[model samples]
Target: MTAADLPEIKILIDATELFPSSMLGEMVQQFLSGNEAKEIWLVLTNPQSVGVAYVAPEKLTDGTFNLLLIAVHPKQQGKGSGTQLIAEVENRLKELGARILLVETSGLEGFELTRRFYLKNGYELEGRIRDFYQDGDDKVIFRKVLT
Candidate 1:
């Protein structure tokens, strides 16, 4: 996505309850400015964005990338938008010779569906960090190997 789409993307982020980022605009701008470390992908329904995926290559690692965030607007959830976004991201990464795509998500009760989404998309549960996010909330990690 380009800088012009930042506003709509931010709205998707907000609506999805993803972690708020005060620097999203600047971050996207830097990516547009040749920050190869970051890439933002969007799924739009004509004028409005319905899904987004923000990813970054893992530093000092060959063919390793992290899916920092992926979300589908509530209204767009339950549709194939998310799976399509995942397929797009994976296809693009495979073209880049990426071997592994990692995703991290909260392990809270509220995030059960989110975790399941990743699993359903061919990402295997790799590990989990106890009390990583807080006293009780954990950080669950999943991995998808792309040949």
Candidate 2:
């Protein structure tokens, strides 16, 4: 998506804390313009919504896509929405020549549900960064081979 898509993308961020959620538009624009990745893939809820997953090209050493953000409206959870979104991403990334996917989640003590969700979705825990959240929470890294 382009920087122009941020306004709509912010609505999706408001449904989750993938980002500050307050500056969804600005955040998306910045991500889109940055050189951190070769490309960014955004999947929306529909023609008028912003619930999405931002998949960026991996960093210098990792030859994969980084799942930067994935937020679904709470009201839409547990209905296979997350799975569908991920499936779309998997297909798109495959087309882009990606061979693996990497994701990281904050290990906030109370965010067990989020951690479990990733595990249930076939992401295997690869490592952890101690106290990575600045709130005494760790950061858990998960990976899934796409090829």
RMSD of each: 1.6, 2.8
Model 2 CA lDDT for position 5:
61
Model 1: colliding residue pairs: none
Deviating ranges (above 4 Å) for candidate 1: 37-40
lDDT of 2 by residue, 57-128 (tens): 766755588888787777677778887888788788887778889889888867788788888889899999
What is the per-residue lDDT of model 1 for residues 1-147, given as tens digits with 9 covering 90 to 100?
Answer: 777777788888788777675557765676778756446455555458888887789989998999987888898898889898989999889988899999998899999999989989999999999999999999999999999
- Relative to the unseen true structure, what is the C-alpha lDDT of residue 132 in candidate 1, on a scale of 0 to 100? 100
Alpha-carbon lDDT of model 1? 0.84
Predictions in order: lDDT? 0.84, 0.75
